[model samples]
Target: MKKILLSIGGLVLLVIAVLLVAPLFISLEDYKPEIAAKAKEATGRDLEIGGKISLSLFPTVAIEVNDVALANYEQGQNKDMVTLEQMALELQVMPLLSSEVVIDRFVLVKPIINLEIDKTGKPNWELEGTQAPANETATTENSESSDGGSGAGLSGLSLGDVRIENGELHFIDLASGAKEDIEALNLEISLEALNEPLSLDGRLDWKAETINLKADVANLESLMNGGSTALEASVNSSPVNFSFNGTAQQASAFALAGALDLDVPSVKGLTDWVGAPIERQSEETFGPLSVKGQLDLNGSVVAFDDVSLAFDALTAQGALKIDSSGSVPNIVAALSTGVLDITPYLPPETSGGQDASSESTSDGGGAVQNAGADQGWSDEAIDFSGLKSVNADLALKSEGVKIRKITIGVSELGILLQGGKLTADLKQLALYDGQARGKVVLDSSKATPTTAINFDLSGVQAEPLLSDSADFEKLLGTLSSKANLTTQGASQKAMVSNLNGTGDFIFQDGAVKGVNIPGLIRNVSLDALQNSFDEAQSTDFAELSGTYTIQQGVVNNQDLSMIAPLFRLSGKGTVPMPPKTLDYRLEPKLVGDLEGQGGDSGAKGLAVPLLITGSWSDPKVAPDLAGALTDQLKDPSALIEGVTSGEGGVKLPLGDGDDAGGVEEVIEKPKEALQKLFGN
Candidate 1:
């Protein structure tokens, strides 16, 4: 029995010795052709091993291969899809006997991978042959078996160091003409055991920038077993830096709750580095941005609480949540800021200020001329497609807000958007020293978008408001206005042409900055006269009120009324917004005093008809000679009596051909009074 046992031991020893020493005489390179042939049959791609192959066993099992490559698709741009200068792997043989995989070092050196998508949407990574449909029962059984064995499979797994040195990955989309390249990717990973901590550190050069990345898992086993584990990760790059520290779990689904910090030196720079540069209206936009918050991600829902965000010199604190489980993402946010100045991101206001000298002069036939007519509203299409990409509910409050040259104070706004329709409620707003509240609804679901606004403004300072908003600084007053307007269009020109609205406005204790009505009427002449409103000359009034209706961009106001110390004025007009022209008539009557707001019957005086016509930018102001003559003749007895009594409040020159006094000529021949009075 002892001799037989000895024989068995000797045979086992001989087998072990052979297993340890057999690799010395054998050459793995000799079977390279067979290996390549098998790989081609499996993948339908040529696999080439140009250099030497070495293998070892016994104390450590190791394999090394050099100069390996895989052929690209027949229609691929590159000759070789993947190439590796060298690959080496080492494993502990003793651990394999215990159902464990303990890797000493697994390294890949200078591997290049080219991933391409053809113009026909075919990818090079897709093998030539079709794959058989997976069996449901078999797949379910396999998945259950794998899940049941996962713990045991990974229980004894260990890794000393796994590394990739200077690898490169290229991606190209032929249909989109887009290319992306990651060069010099060096990574190192270390795992003592499945139950212990795991760490990874890596660096990559992309788009002429280097990115440093690191991650740590406190307990890899716990994480794999659907339990929570402490996790920390960071990515640092020239354009942006991001870091997160928190707990991660994968119980029913992956989830995380942690603190995240992200800083971007310049969004534009980061976008450019990613080969997706964004276009901005101003150079000042897309500048520095930073965010810090507590993030909770559960399934497809992500929430950020106590978020502090800074962008383009504007800072705010907010809470935001996003749910992507639906067809479109839904966002909810509440933000507040001290002063939100978004002027840098706003498009510049058009240059619309006209010079005072551009007004009508003697050479222009008394017609006011604008320095230059605006090019008109932009016809560029307004893209509302983005609005349909997501649904959002947002509430924003700010101590002050600035957009372009317009400044507003203490505003609270709530916006809700769903299915390409947006409703904005201005709950509270202080604008131009006034209170403004309004609601705006925009529907972009249709082919042609539509907008409706119901706004009310009171006690607003009109001068500064108009100056900043529209470059119209001629009127100074406390203004109150209400408007309910609706329009449908995708472009400014179309919107204005389709506008329909009803509004009423009142201006109190104001002055018309450019014109003195009395002076203009007193200096009446058939020849051209200056009617510029940009000068310091003005007419003070107690009130100016009007109710207007707009249809197809044409505004008509028939009850315009003004009260002044020396005169009462009434006007009616049509303002075509599309053409930016005005056709208005004003009748001003001399009043006895500033009493009863021009309603006192005793304050009536001579009435002169004045006409304002032409573009809003340059209106022509002149007396309606025919209308005035007819008005005076309608009440000839009162006019003559007043003229004889020297209380007509008017003076006309007698004919130059005759030495007739003006009053006598007017009293003697009422029928031909105007003809005689004008020396006709």
Candidate 2:
């Protein structure tokens, strides 16, 4: 028939020309010590091979190696755990001559791995010094294959393209001196039969950026039969962009369920690329993030449902869970946000000296400055060491919550930490129409950290929370507060000077905007310094309660009280608060029968103590006249009933600008000592 088909193609061209000259008479580097003793009997480390060992067989069986290395753990600095410059392989020589093994490409070109751990956490890719365990024919004759739970050993294998070039991956942790690297790694994989579908695309270079990754699995026999497969991953990087889309459950407990999606654009460069940096004391700048989620994981517990986060102009919604098999990784979350303008993470509002009588207690919400702990409170140095990193139980909520001009309308906050304590509750807080609840905890498991704080608030709105904390807009309206307090100090001026607390407050129809009390009882009004918080001489008050007590930072207010239908007030205090100064005493009375008066302040006509020293930002009120000369030495007609019931008339001035003796010569010597005791 054509010379019998040219004699069977001349015996297939003499067996492909004797398998291409049989590797040029085979000296394959003289079997390189049996190929480096079967790679040191399958990697018990040491496998040198310095260069050249080549072979090939008819468009199939190929192998080429040159300068490989691979050892590790003779201790530290580079015992070389893999280093290959040039490697190439191809198989399927008729299904590995029937032992069935496939693999048609495996190129490596410029690899350099490293992967260490040392300093006690021993790891240099393990497989230490004794190497002898690898039965099943050394798992398909080692071609670097071993994910073998039956089928990553790929049932009758068949992989095709895999080329990694310029690879590098050097990680180190010698006990947290943490180091990482993965440079210029390039990978491309595509498999054809571990039962279909699998592809990977990669690129590396970390920290100095450039990420790019992609993956797809799609079944692969349901991911080698451990169940649900279908995965698609993606990553891009500059400041983060990540993605994932789903289903990879139960591969021996590596379960998953995804839909991640992320974009960062710098959340401090993704926490400085995950090394966690955001140690703020205030040069804040978070940013451009967006999340979106539904992660799930189900094995070591890793949920994250519905999420949807954003930052910079805040917006949140969430659910989270973390659980990593315990030993310190447990988290829970629940979020909500919108309008959480924490002034771009704080520290920018600072304006402290103002007092033109505080401009008549300005309102429209901007005269109450100070807030953020009155321009201070962060003496830094509060590291709580990142709160030991994990254990949490967050819960944040917001809906209006600025933090500079201080405004809060709806808020809910909760946080918990275990093992080094850390509470923080406040569940539900609405201010300015008030309602609050509180808790604060913070115990760093001792050695001086302690801090507890109980709190309560109700019906709030006391002039913008005391004008954003003590800038004092001169009190006005429905308030209620409570505190329990405790401290151990770690700044904030040592927690307000090591405070030991006990607080209470109440306002109700309040007014006190700079005091006038009937013009200091008919004009003993010493020069009227714009009448204090003069909304037309404040002091309306239908109630203004108190109950303070803190020691060690001094503050004691013996049940101060004030009610004013005509007048009735009381006080006694000592506020040492790190020199916030103010030595208190304020007693005014005249609630009944004094003509323009209602009744029963004990039917008193007038009584006055009023001392109030200075420095809670300029205090100093007058009218004590040595307690009305000790009450006219015990009532010698008490200065003719304090000059006909105007106990504070005559301007008994004395805030060091003397004149405590001319109210009609002290009302004529208490009426000439009551007429020499009755001999009138």
Collision count for each candidate, in order = 0, 3
| 435-468 per-residue lDDT for model 1 (tens digits) | 9999999999988999999999999999999998
Please name the candidate that would achieve the greatest TM-score relative to the true structure.
1
Task: Please give each candidate's TM-score.
Answer: 0.88, 0.38
How well is each residue in 1-680 modelled by candidate 2, as lDDT tens digits?
Answer: 99999999999899989998888897888888886787777766678888887888976888889888977767868878888988998886777766667888888988999888878898777774455457855875664355545465456676787789978888988887899988889999887776677888988888788888988887676666577877888898888888888888656687778789898887876897778878543444586888888898877888889998887677899898889897778899998888886766765555565644343232232121122222334666566766766789899888878777778888889899887788989888888787889899998767668798998998888998778866778778898889898978666677778888889887777666645664454333334323332444456666678788898778898877776554467788898877677788877653322222233334343455667665664455566746744754575344455433545332221121111111222223444423322224
Off by over 4 Å in 1: 1-15, 129-152, 279-283, 355-365, 371-381, 521-523, 526-534, 596-603, 636-680
Q: Candidate 1 at residue 497, lDDT?
A: 96
In candidate 2 the C-alpha lDDT for residue 436 amounts to: 85
Give the Å error, residue 596, model 2: 11
What C-alpha lDDT values do all the predictions have? 0.81, 0.70
Q: Candidate 1, 365: how far from true, in Å?
A: 4.6
